[model samples]
Target: MKTLLVDDHEIVRRGLKQLLLEAFPQAVFGEASRVPQARELIMQQEWQLVLLDINLPGGSGLDLLVEVRLLRPQAAVLMLSSYPEEEFAVRAFKLGAAGYLTKSSVADEMLAAVNKVLTGGKYVSVALAEKLAIALGNPQQQALHETLSSRELEVLRLVATGKTIKEIAAGFSLSEKTIATYRMRIAVKLGLSTNVELARYALQHHLVD
Candidate 1:
């Protein structure tokens, strides 16, 4: 079995390799820490499964998820994140991820999720499932932040976490002007003028750390 671990943290990749090795001793693994590297690997090879992290350096995991689904439709992508919000999980499912797992997941649960994904089944934690239930069961309960596009929402999260426009632009490989435009667009969409308000809104909505 060929599995790709796409996370920015080397330690996380190492730990996951070790954990997954217990169950998939014979598995061949590939690792990528950035979107470009991940995309190159995705285009060059076929993966049986991909454990993708949501907040990649160059782009969002959702972007790579879409590309991976297009390029390697047979591969199962299980998203990993520190954020356990239902919004993120729902977006991943909508973008064709096979599962969403938090970094705080227990080892057994992680293995189970990987097993289920490999077997062509989706894995959703009970916590997330319950949250999804609330969201799905009550469509009116959706937050205004849900209306933001993936890119805009990501920018907002970064801004909320105290990233300057230049820093965010650098990380995204986008022009400073473009990043500013995105920030402006987010303000217009969310109707929040100052960074403080944006930060408060993001925190209240659990969009940031």
Candidate 2:
């Protein structure tokens, strides 16, 4: 099997490579540290699966996932992130990721998750599974933030975390005007008229830590 590991951190990529080598000795693995590098590698190779980090230096992993789905329809993508499962797991799945696993996940769990995805199965941590089940069982139990677009949700999250529009724009490498637009859209979607209200809603829903 061929696998690609995409992460910006050298230590993380190295550690994950070592773990995969131990678990699947016969698998061929490739690593990339940025979206452009990953994109180039993807075009040059046919990978069976991709282990992706949600945060990259120059681009969003979610954007990469969309491109990957189009370029390699047969390749399974497992999203690995430091963010909490409830924050982005559902959105990742909806965007065609095969699974979502947080960086805090145990080694055994991570191995099992990769194995499951290689076999065309989805994997989520036990705790996240329960959360998903409950959310599915009762639509009303779903977090309101889940209704926001990926961009809006991101803006809401940063806003709740006390980032100003300028900071958010710098963080995302976007224009201040674009960030402001996203903030406006988020407010409109959630029926919030002010950043304070948005922050309060995010806190109430646990969107911000």
Name the candidate that leads on TM-score: 1
Best by lDDT: 1
Listed in order, each prediction's TM-score against the native is 0.92, 0.83
> Over the stretch 75-159, how does candidate 2's per-residue lDDT look in tens digits?
9999999878987899999999999998889899999998899889999788988998998899997766788887777778788
Error of 2 at 143 (Å): 1.2
Q: lDDT of each model, Cα atoms only? A: 0.91, 0.87
In candidate 1, residue 83 scores what lDDT?
80
- Model 1: colliding residue pairs: none
- Candidate 1 residue runs with Cα over 4 Å from true position: 175-177
How far residue 186's Cα lies from its native spot in candidate 1, in Å, is 1.6
Candidate 1 at residue 181, lDDT? 96
Question: For each candidate, C-alpha RMSD in Å?
Answer: 1.7, 2.7
Q: Give the Cα-based TM-score of candidate 2 against the true structure.
A: 0.83
